[model samples]
Target: MKIGLYFGSFNPIHIGHLVIANHLAEYSDLDQIWFVVTPHNPFKKKNSLLDNYQRLEMVYLATKDYAKLKPSDIEFNLPQPNYTVNTLAYLQDKHPDHEFALIMGEDNLKSFHKWKNYQVILENHHIYVYPRITKNIEASQFDGHEKIHAIDAPIMELSSTFIRKAIKARKNVEPMLPKNVWEYLDEMNFYR
Candidate 1:
């Protein structure tokens, strides 16, 4: 099986995320896209994040109906400030029968060179990059590597940060998030 790892904080899995995952599953060669909920991202602020379990639950609610899209809690057990290289290595080791790839946005690719062991990641796994607003990835920078693929998936300007801010302002978030996820957030009074 070819699995694409879509890692994120998923602070509250929003419609934009679901849209991206759906497009990837429908249009790409990936057999499955696992939404790896990171417990903590070294590049992001820790205090603003919701608890890992809550974030994981939101992902579960958002992806419940999609068989090809799975919510993963693998990073919850991993060490804090999880590095993508380490997580990918561990997953590859544990699931040798399954081929793994990394799914990311064009914005992340801009900073790809700064990531720990980026060269190993590029050599060992394929990177499926989707477009993001205001971030353009230069293909030439990668020297036309066959492993680096640009996917023609739908790009949404929406982000988890926007959703959190909206919720805090008591703004309607139904249009931005899955119904179940919105309901869960309202029920838990999260991000208020």
Candidate 2:
């Protein structure tokens, strides 16, 4: 099976995340899209993030209905400030029978070179890039890279940061989040 690992903090899982996962699962060669909830992203601020378990739970609630989409807490047990290469190596070692690929957006691609052992990741695994609203990365940038695949997934303008801010301001975020996730947020009073 070909699995696409969609890594993110998922502070609160939003519609944008679901749309991309569903698009990749339906349109790409990937058999499944796993939302690998990172405990802490090296490139992001840890203070602003929700608890790792809370974020993971939101991911579970948001994606439970999708057959091809699954929430993963694989990084929770790993070292803090997890690196993609390490997670990939670990997954490869644990699930040798399944071929794993990466699913990211054009924005992430713009900063791909900054990631730890990015070259190793590019050399060993396929990278599926979805279009991002503000990013303008062209296929020509990765013209010589056969493993880099550009997908025509829809661009979602909504972002987790925006949702978080809206929630903090006591604004309605029901439309941006999945029903279960929103209910969970309401129950927990998250980000308020």
Candidate 3:
């Protein structure tokens, strides 16, 4: 099976994430899209993140209704300060029968070169890039690269940060997230 790994903290799984994943799963060559919830991202601040299981639960709630989308806690058991290259390697070893690709935003493409062992990653896996509203341009080296495929998915500007802040400020941000995810967050009183 061809799976596209959509890696993120998913601090709280929101509609923006579902839109992109659903678009990729339905429109791209990928058969399924896995939400690889990272326990710790080297580039992101750990302080702002919720517990790994809590974040995973939100992802489960958000993606449960979609057959093509599935939540994965693959990184939770992996070592801390998770890096993309390492996780990719681990997945490749464990799921040798499956062909794994990457799902990322155009904003992340701008910094693709900075990732550890980026050359090795590009050589082994394909990257499906979705549109993002970012000022920085993608690296020239990635332009027209065979390994990187630019998908014409919808541009989602909504962010988990915005949702979290809205909830904390006592504002209604229900429309921003999946209904079950919003209910889960509200029930748990998270981000407040």
Candidate 4:
């Protein structure tokens, strides 16, 4: 099966995430979109995130209704400060029968060249990029790249940071998240 790996911290899964994954699952060639919950993102501060299990549970709750979308903890057991290239290689070795691709936003694509061993990733796997509202355009190096595909997925401006801030401020962000996720957050009093 062709699986698109959508990696994220997912401090809390939200509707914007669901939309993008669902869009790619329905519109793209991918058989499934796995939400690879990163235990710790190198670009983010670990202190700001919830427990890894908590975040993964939220992901499971948010994606339960969708068959094509599934939550993954593939990076949880990997070494801290893990890079995408290593994960790709590991996944390939472990699941030789399945093909894995990447799902990222256009903003991420702008800095794709800076990732560790990005050329190796490009050579082996395809990347599906969704449009993001960013001021700077993508780098010219990616133009006409056969391995990269620009998907006409919805541009979601919603972010987990905004949701966290709102929840801490005691604002009603129920609509931004899935019902199960919202209930779990409310019950746990998370982000407050």
- What shift in Å separates residue 144 of candidate 1 from its native position after superposition? 2.1
Considering only N, C-alpha and C atoms within 3 Å, which residue pairs clash in candidate 3?
none
Question: 1-192, model 2: which lDDT tens digit per residue?
Answer: 999999998988899999999999999899999999988887777999889889999998888888999999999999876799999999999999999999988888877888899899988999998887774545545655899998999889899999999999999999999999999999998999
User: Given candidate 1, what's the lDDT at residue 65?
Assistant: 93
Q: Ten residues in a row with the worst lDDT in model 2?
A: 135-144
Which ten contiguous residues of candidate 3 have the minimum total lDDT? 132-141
Q: After superposition, how far is residue 155 of candidate 3 from its true place, in Å?
A: 0.5
Alpha-carbon lDDT of model 4: 0.95
Go through the candidates in order and give each one's C-alpha lDDT: 0.90, 0.90, 0.93, 0.95
Worst 10 residues of 4 by lDDT: 134-143
lDDT for model 1 comes to: 0.90
TM-score attained by model 4: 0.97
lDDT tens readout by residue for model 4, 24-91: 99999999999999998888788999999999999999999899999999998999889999999999
Report the Cα RMSD per candidate. Answer: 1.4, 1.5, 1.1, 0.9
Query: How many backbone clashes can be found in candidate 3?
Result: 0
At residue 90, give the lDDT of candidate 2.
98
Residue-level error in angstroms, candidate 4, position 13: 0.8
For every model shown, the clashing-pair count is 0, 0, 0, 0
**Of the pair 1 and 3, which is ahead by lDDT?**
3
